[model samples]
Target: MELLAGARIALTPRPVERRHAALEVAMLGHCPGRVRLERLLQLPAALADMRAVGYGQAVDAFSSGAASELYNLPIPLQSSAEFHDIFPDALTATTEYVSLLAGNKAWLGLAVDDFFANGGEKLWVVRIPESAGQAGFLPADATQLHDITTLQGLACVLVIPALGVVGFPDLERLQIPPRLPDIPRVRLENFEPQFLPCTQNTEDDHRERRYSSELSDMPPPWQLPQVLRGMLQYVSSHRPDLQCLFTLPLAYSGELDSPVLDPTALSALSGYQQLPDRAQALRHVQFLFPYLRGPRFALHTPVGLIAGQQAAVARRDGPWRSMAAKPLNTDALPYPRLSIAQTLGLRDKPGISVLNYRNSFSGGAQLSLDDERLVVPALPVADYPVDRQRYDGFCSAEVMRFLGFLRRQLQALGEQLIFNLDYRDPRPRLLLEQFFRRLYSQGALRGASAEQAFSIRESTPQEGAMLYEIMLAPAFPIDRLFLTFANLNGEWRSEVVDG
Candidate 1:
């Protein structure tokens, strides 16, 4: 993970020994601090609630090396949702933040609520593992019909009629008949779940904007546009091989406050055609499109809830235009590796773009029917935030790390060679050339011949130093779309162009 430092050309080899691989990530959320000294002691209890709820694995990513550490901010706040307000300066100063970036063994996930309250802010994410959050209950028997209040603050759940429990949130809209038939149903509510006392108060305390349940203090909304820019800037500069993913809670206000009803959302859902400037959340997401440019992070949220909401709308107002299955910038947000390589006259390089992720089911809730019993499986508590695309990005980074190791090794080996102008002696230039040529022969370069893939030569010694110059045209993966049409018998036939 260490970069080549200083101008010295010789390479230093540190013996490779087995050690914990760095997955250094930090999770920042809110906890009552100095001003709320009374509440400080409750922090452990609150974290205990997080672990009990299913965020144990995610929190373990940071705490596994050491017990999960909690550093209090001097400033006191109502909730971590405002964590976005004290970002950058306040964020970077914390012990947890410092440790994450300073090559420590552990990583963290801090929940500063509603991060990205301001724009043009930046943040770095090391590696926060995903979690399958806490659960709510729904009983199997008809006698427990009136027990909905037991699971009050839950937003959604799986109705394991034979095994588990079911939860609440105005189930009147579901219309269970007088007899309450045992039929399977998938219900996603408009209410945001308020489970963590650290992030938000109980439902009885307030119905204020809420999103996903947090096992620890971390932002519910993933990739806050402004925040994503900051994370991208940090990661691209510090660790291009690593990537980040965001998870947004499915929260709803009044009918008008819902994302499904929002006109700009409607526009985006249609064809990504036009969006109003007023849609701040969607706009924040929109900003990362063809412009932000690299693939270091992916945004993961409960888009299925939004889609379901749209379906509800269709049942009521009739379908307008079909809704978009994903974001308009879905294709554009990934790094355009093929085009860039082509522009640079290099072969296409695959796996250079950021990943795109959509929840198969918002909250990862699914329903299945068993003979006589309507079985709703246990909600995927730890896996809801899981994303494999981000893993692919990590794999790509590991490759880069290996490449860096090889580069350093080559430099070191070359330092052992004699640099001379003698005709019979192989100069440093020849050694470097051999290295790159080997790379090409190993399928690292794109071309039918080494001559097409790269050019390396010994430039005239610069005043007093010898220099070897290399121009490499890396192979790129094909990623362009083209159509060809031919006129035959006064009819036009269209065909896709193959690479």
Candidate 2:
């Protein structure tokens, strides 16, 4: 948005700044009639982040009516204690509101995501144990909580509890450390807004070493195939443009000692060398083609794996000794693989055009002592994995809107540039091609040759209506790095390869 704002300022006249203008932001708190009330909780932090980046005067879709009652205090409520004292009713009101929503099945996953995304200190969700009924309530079961995040198709939920939820007393006992509820230090695993770099694994200083909890949990045995199948189908349905997607195991929590199901056990159960490929896997999604002998890195890590890493490479020992040195094949993985570390690093790199789940704070971070969520001094923001796609797709859509405006203006003047009045005229098609060529000349698309950068093909499927297919190789971010090794004498020199 900041970049777009700058662009808007540069394109408009200097006098335009003097005139009053407003930018309205509208967002959904919940999908109407959906069995989910917690969908909009993550929205708060997202809005906060946007505001910090110069997006202001935006109205909240859910709570705009309450705006008149709210005030921006000169001395901001610095702590929860301050918030409690200033507005005693607010805490209880919020607690009751959360409790009511927490009873629903969707709340278990949505609430955790909301709390983490919003950087809240702690979130407690109470469930009535079946053995005790309504009178004797307890924190939700550990296994149940884990399943809520993993098996229940909520792998996107990041803050999975390391231990079961504990009991909490009334407001009077809240401040006392001993009497307060013992909410477990939930693992900020699986797609954290920030990550530690995997490159410096040898660094002894834990404080200096970086790590990425991008894929924290490993889903249950039966869940892996389902996730892969669904995403693969989605990509396949939207081919060419959506040919490939960056993926991590959405099965289990990385916080768990043993998050994923054993591949050997899976193979034994199925009596096959690899997990059975779904119907979608039988087809390809363009780009590279490789017959995967195993799914080693794909199941266990967030690393990119290619055909070169397959075990079959090791079998053919003629001249290609490097291939022979590779590890034994495990199972066939159908996707273009990269580790979470690599994926995060490429969030802003150029040239690459793959879709990934990475964010601004993937480099390194400090956990807020108050909230236990990632805190980057530069950009204190938290977002879900899908936000990467949303942000990228949004910018592209805005550019398209601008181009559409230009096209509309041309049509109003009866210029046969974007839309040809007569389908038989070759001048409109030539003009359209020249328009895109100008964009390429001005360095709009990502490529060396104009042909590689953009292309326009006219289609007339109907008698009167004309369709134009504008192809562009959108740029991708190189937010990750991989090691490159060169044997210098007896010592191997390592170099970094940007994605």
Candidate 3:
């Protein structure tokens, strides 16, 4: 008889591992022409000189690299202090070329500074090339919109498995002029002439130069809703683990007091109708309002500040902690200040979050996040109730982040065991259960006991894949509080009431 062939064993080595930090953020925007001078210098001598001179002279020169490129900036090492040294095109008081081409105001630079100042540790900057035209600000044409909706515009960011949040600072810049307001003329009619140390050949004289006014016109307000919808959908479908933090475009004529009433307002509560109906898409998007003004910078969107806060909160506590009602550690103040009634109105809106001032015990007013809300739809009535088992967990940003964290952790575990484990192996299941128990011990899950906190079970396998169903009871933040005050027996007393 022929000898039986020994069983063949094909060993599959595990793939290379990549680690991701929690709550990392990616910012996509336009950079000044000085940022690309290094790459231009690598060209032929004649071509390099021509492009450099031409770029300096042009207002909308193509300085950014391909849309797929990402510039990683680690905290402290490559912080704002080293920003100019790293990217020569960065806006500096002495960089005349940047002032001429970019109006001496780079939103990207300000955003980067705000991010680092607010406790952000890791950042990825995606520069939108000038070739994108209006799309570099907000998608204007069909081709531009296609790039965003298809996820090609943010391909570099999306490829990073660890990216937790993303924002488009330049997107809101489309609502305002690129240049800052001109210095107001002062009247010296009533002032008495005084001798001062003045020299006709002062060094400051060489710094004064007229900036270009050929900046691009502000895009129409209607384009905002369309662009936002595309972004929401892109993040939802391609990377559900990520959150898109956005700043609503400012009102065209007046203050953003009543965002729900204006259909043109991108942050309008009613504007959700223009977005995709999928709950997944809506939950992945968040909007902040009114912009902010600080001593170091002019009026700018609060996306950078909020993104930094999210990272800081996630690192200090857990991603499940709510960022609302917490004092921001920045000196920036909200612009077009809203009255108490207006602030309450904004707080009541289900989609938008507002930044407002609160009186602290130290006798000073502090800027704080009023609420943390997602772009989810309103709950349905009991009669025509849809399955909300999944939807309910995503209504809060805190819950959404917790779920994303679990997804990342589970994904990493699976990757590590892909080639080493068998479908029938019990070790993987034990590891998963232990992993959840560890989370429960860490206060991520809420329950009187382990059984109530979470439940894990193997699901029916499909094809060649093993599956598991994990039901989790994540701890939620206290969003509302009730007080009972009554006058009893000639005494006034107040007690906490349960909802």
Error of 1 at 174 (Å): 31
Best candidate, lDDT: 3
Worst 10 residues of 2 by lDDT: 371-380
Q: What's model 3's TM-score?
A: 0.72
- How much does each candidate deviate from the true structure in C-alpha RMSD? 23.8, 20.6, 13.5
* Per-residue lDDT of model 3, residues 1-499, tens digit only: 0123463552222212223345778787666555533333232332332233222222123333333232221111124444434454544433111222123355666777777677776676666664454355332224332232333345545655667888877656544433333233344455475665766433443332454454334334335656666675546666778777776654323333222223355344455534335443566767677677777655566887787888878888878787787677778888646677776665555556788888988898998887787656222222113444344334567766777777778887999998999877889999988998888887888899988999988965686678889888777555557998999999999999532
Model 1 per-residue lDDT tens digits across residues 233-317: 3233322232232221122224433211112322332232122222111211211111112122111122112222222323333
lDDT of 3 at 51: 33
In candidate 2, what are the lDDT values of residues 68-96, reduced to their tens digit?
Answer: 21211011111223222323332123222
Regions of candidate 1 where Cα sits further than 4 Å from its true position: 1-225, 232-427, 460-464, 480-498
Error of 3 at 56 (Å): 31
lDDT rank order: 3, 1, 2
Displacement of the residue 92 alpha carbon in candidate 2, Å: 12
Candidate 1 weakest ten by summed lDDT: 369-378
Runs with alpha carbons beyond 4 Å of true place in candidate 2: 1-221, 227-235, 238-257, 260-444, 449-452, 459-499
Score each candidate by Cα lDDT.
0.27, 0.27, 0.59
After TM-score superposition, the amount by which residue 63's alpha carbon in candidate 3 deviates from its true location, in angstroms, is 19
